[model samples]
Target: MGQGGSREFEGGPEGFPPGSERRSARQAEEAPQENAVVPTVLQWSQGGQSVYVTGSFNAWGERIPLRRSGNDCVVCLNLLPGTYQYKFIVDNEWRFAADQPTVRDEMGNINNCITVEDQTSFMREEQPSGFFDNNQNLYTQALPDEITLAKEPPQAPSHLWCLPLNFPPLCEPHVASWTLLPPLGVTLTHLLAAAADRSTNTLSVTQRVRSKFVTMVFIKPARGSAADARLGPAPAGGQAAGGGFALPQLPSTAAAVAAQQQL
Candidate 1:
């Protein structure tokens, strides 16, 4: 066969080997993940009816039982990058491993200590690249070795506020405009539309159900509900500046608008 044709090769495609591409892809997939967890194993050699492990890993809230291996008790955990303090519970008795490092707490109780480092060294590497600018949500923060949550929610601000239940007649030339413009019975749409607005006051209404299916309108002031707006400096003036009416600003802006309509 002289210079006429070419022979097929065992490797895939031209010049490329079959397993080379696969090997590269497999290596890529096997690469360590960001902030990857580290596997930790804890063991207690003393024999007992049941051995449990509890510590900072779960705030000591959940107790994980250790599996028996010969006379030794063992437990394996996948933990994030952080330092943890723990203790062993042997037969319902609190204790720490005598062989491991130990530290005393503020309460004068001794606890074992373990530090779990990230496999990928994510904590050491330059923080995630995508977090552009000072984006608070995306930007990472240096978290302390310890984590804790408040036992109770913060207290609410002390402020007084209320909306007027009764509204004055519509400002239209004909009093019937208020009734005819809005269909049949009163609805939320109309109530808010006719309600007065004050730059310094805010109003909100809630419909409540009665024993006989009667819809009762409950008005409430929302001015003080805004933490930012409430704290901001109050505006200067008594009244007589707004287009709706020059009535004095009251706890209920809706009531002031109604009173303005009367005049």
Candidate 2:
């Protein structure tokens, strides 16, 4: 009922070389007799300095790096028939291609999605039709049963939990505190999942939690100017006065938020 659930998805027709793949949304309904892997290529065309993709295939653990192709970054993978939700990390920022199919998790976090169908039915559909584009893909929409997986795993359990706005994460202060603000000139409102930078030793907390704003906070550095403390509750013995926010709740005023910048 756990990772075993993922196996049923991997059972499909054998995949061909990348150039031999077929693409269509209608072919999914006809489960022709086939058994092998499916070749999947994920592309990020938003233009970023660096891009990598990660999702359900690897339990959302390791990010598969994408190679640059003109204005796009692309990666090809051998996946079995299944539904997967993924987003690209563009220049260390979490983002999804809005033009593609998307699904939101329980927390309203959105990610680009792809569905790989069996190869047999897919190959059979191209009966002497005009040649398909060299870059055509086989992504299809989810069937009834597969829709349930949209929420199966987006983030790990630690960051999956939701806390109401202004609710304290720990009774005492955490690391240093940095206010969260939307990127300048950004208007479309959407949720950004929690992420931590190990090299910078910074933790970002973002939660909507009945609030309209997708607010976030950068846990300040407990050390000197460099924030060296990890994001979490205080140490075992006692609380550190400078570890968390001085205020009982986050700043809520328009004046307070308008002048802020993300850490």
Candidate 3:
């Protein structure tokens, strides 16, 4: 039989330094079986200026510790899935973030909101081969439930509501006032939900009956502009204007329409 060469394991079979092997073994025992994934890092900077990020996640205004490289500042933190708003504090004063719906921080200050997508769902969709690129802003995530929405829409509460094409401004003599517009762009689903449902005669209605009122809005003629003389009037108090438009005893058979020429 041929002689077998002696084997030597680096740092010993304990897989640690010889003298400190006992302590290293203790540390390995204490450590969890699986290490957590390192959080994604975000770098914020503008025109060679270093900016600091701070917001609700880090106790509102407290500066998030960052590492500077050239002009860019970076921060990494493990954040749970949900909506979060943050702002970059540049040069200790100027705050910057996307301008849209301003989000309020925990300290009641407005900050820029950023949504952290569900990581698990996003990873599942991306699969095992590809990795997330830091430079990309848009990402795709999978929703838990099937996104099937019915096309059939709900019916409007009453046929009295009108949508006026010619909207007149407030305190003006005009027909087809802006008020006539049936709360522009209000979805049929929402209006029906607002009105009382007489089917079961649910008595626990919360909203008080609003009083009916009338007003006229006049659209001032554009300065020295040639346009048709337009004026409109509509029920000012919304559905409160009960007597102005009577609800038909028989529900509208058509695709639930609001009368236009009746007024």
Candidate 4:
């Protein structure tokens, strides 16, 4: 299991490292575009079945009560700009999508995946290198013995969980039986992609996050009615404060222009 780092990264008070060369390079690269501010309603047809949709967004419901929306077990989530992994927990059994798959959990369960683009949900305020900070942490965390990367792409299945960003901390940490140790000097872009890939394939950690790439929800596929499922209003769950994957120490300050964005 990866433990939390005691010290923040040492850049400066504003937490942005000082430099123009790397900043300029990042500007040159193409990142995914932001499509909307509010999350568009996402719908899927399990067509007349009760599928329990759960993930880190919902504290990995010990039993996630699915929502009944007509014929589908509809769930809603508000996510930041990034990738997240999820799966369908159908009829009490965990399963990943048959397409677009990746790795397995510490308990040896595989998961399905989804990606929410950059600046989607949590960009209301400006914070430099928000997601990228977690990207750098992947390199620092100690790797478990079980995780390994797949040689090919994975599959995905469909179900729904209406996970909120402020989901409670999972009491039990989801582990990766087959984990991947990232190589040295990896960038945030590649790190995010890799974490997303892991969500499809590995067991989850207890830490909560909302990227399209990494989440936990895999269940057995069966035919049934979602209408039979019961769900009360979600607890007053709040969104995560941006703690994700592994994190390096935060920088102590920022450059002048970057510092001004904080005001």
Candidate 5:
């Protein structure tokens, strides 16, 4: 009698009966099956030695290679309903899908765009707050053992130049000349002409000074024949200096002289 009582107590409110345990085990096994993700196919029809897809979905960090299916390369992903931007790397060259929508990323490169929509919101609640919360773990689970994620691509180098500013007196009569020494292999014809003619107010001069290799510009007072007196005596090189006025030496280069002839 005591054995019977002990058995009944063991299968009480918090416990399952003998056969019920097996039923619960079967239910646990089937739970994941019920929540299984539907596969979405992404295919690239172009032929290449190797192809890959990388995008914002995986923090734009991991590259997922595609397998050849018939004439096309394809990849299957179980993505939640959302917009994603991606680009393909074919044999190491990056490209966008031909027929799909595209947009320029912050770096100015065009990327293919995609939108995933779930037929029902049933799986939405199961997803975490952010899809990439643990990007490494998510990527591991999303890809099969055969597929490998690629290393992050290197970024392009950027160049920026900052020029110093020198402002002359606004109301005072003055002459300004500027000399530009461009970096090696760079030419500044239009730039130099624009800089020299900016204060001249002569349209014809601007039109004439179109040399592509101009390196210097000189500006003088437009009015008054006594400009030399206002600027003081010419230096040994026949260039005026001092008294807030400077006359630059004439350009020596044949290309420069021809450009100056127009002014």
Candidate 6:
């Protein structure tokens, strides 16, 4: 009995007592090992023969090459929750991220920027089955007939009616006043009526006759033509009154023939 008691008091192999080994094992089991949390991944979608990412995260010293998947070259970076400025090197040439936000560095060079946030609460709140939970009941209730009806077509513009109608002339006179004017007044009235007509052929003929008459009056002013007298003196620069229509120095007979043919 004494030998068994002494054996119990003595230590076990490796100087560890029998009960101590069991106690240490229990303590180790109670204090569980903690697993490392996976880092957040950042990805880029540009594809090239060779692509790499270098940024402030790596002190701009390391070049992480992107892996090509189908048409896109992507790189996975384990980033902490913070902002980062970076750029892509494609085919040995530097490039900024196409769609990411950018900021100018001290050297005036643009760099792509990104922000990371802790996703623990986001992961917990996300619903896999009902992705749009807020909008699910929105379409369940029927809408009113009036609300569902298609909107009325927009109204036409006010000036649409003016098309195909000749614009009014810049000058006008009462009937008695026109009669007091020279016989040229009657000719102008006829010309104005022809201009206001919607017929294209008639308008073309009137324009040609009017141009020829004005050219003739300016080039070889008739001794006492009523229109020429009423027009007063020609401006110093040879520009005619009533819109400064310049009289051609040399009128060609060919142009007159062409104008007549266009009538």
User: Against the true structure, what is each candidate's TM-score?
Assistant: 0.33, 0.34, 0.28, 0.26, 0.32, 0.32
lDDT winner between 3 and 5, please give it.
5
What tens-digit string does per-residue lDDT give for candidate 6 at 84-141?
6677766656788767789876556777887766555666766546533566555657
| Tens digits of lDDT, candidate 1, 1-263 | 01123232232222233454454345434545456778899999866676778766664546677888888889999876666777876765677898988887645667788877666754465644552545677535877575454367756333211122344446776567433222223333223322464433433333322211112233333244455365564445522355222333223445545655798
Local accuracy by lDDT, each model = 0.54, 0.54, 0.43, 0.39, 0.52, 0.51
Off by over 4 Å in 4: 1-44, 47-49, 62-64, 69-71, 99-103, 106-108, 120-263
Candidate 5 lDDT, tens digit per residue, 217-254?
34554333465447665456654444344444344456
lDDT of 2 by residue, 38-75 (tens): 88999888887767777656545466678888887889
Instruction: Evaluate model 2: give its lDDT.
Output: 0.54
Which ten residues in a row are the worst by lDDT in model 2? 1-10
Q: What does candidate 5 score on TM?
A: 0.32
lDDT, candidate 4, 1-263, per-residue tens = 01122222222112123552244335324333345433623343554344655443333433344577776555666654444445565543455556454555444456555565555346566555743454655675676685555365554322111122124444444745333332222222221221233123222222212221223323211123242133322234321245222333232334433644677
- Cand. 3 Cα-lDDT: 0.43
RMSD of each predicted structure? 25.5, 30.1, 24.0, 41.3, 25.5, 23.4
Error of 2 at 89 (Å): 0.7
lDDT of 3 by residue, 92-142 (tens): 454554433467533455566665555565455543343444545334586
Q: What lDDT does candidate 6 reach at residue 51?
A: 70
Sequence-dependent TM-score of model 2: 0.34
Runs of candidate 3 exceeding 4 Å displacement: 1-38, 47-50, 98-110, 122-263
Q: Enumerate residue pairs that collide in model 2.
A: 12-36, 13-35, 13-36, 14-35, 14-36, 174-243, 175-243, 176-220, 177-220, 221-227
Highest-scoring model, TM-score? 2
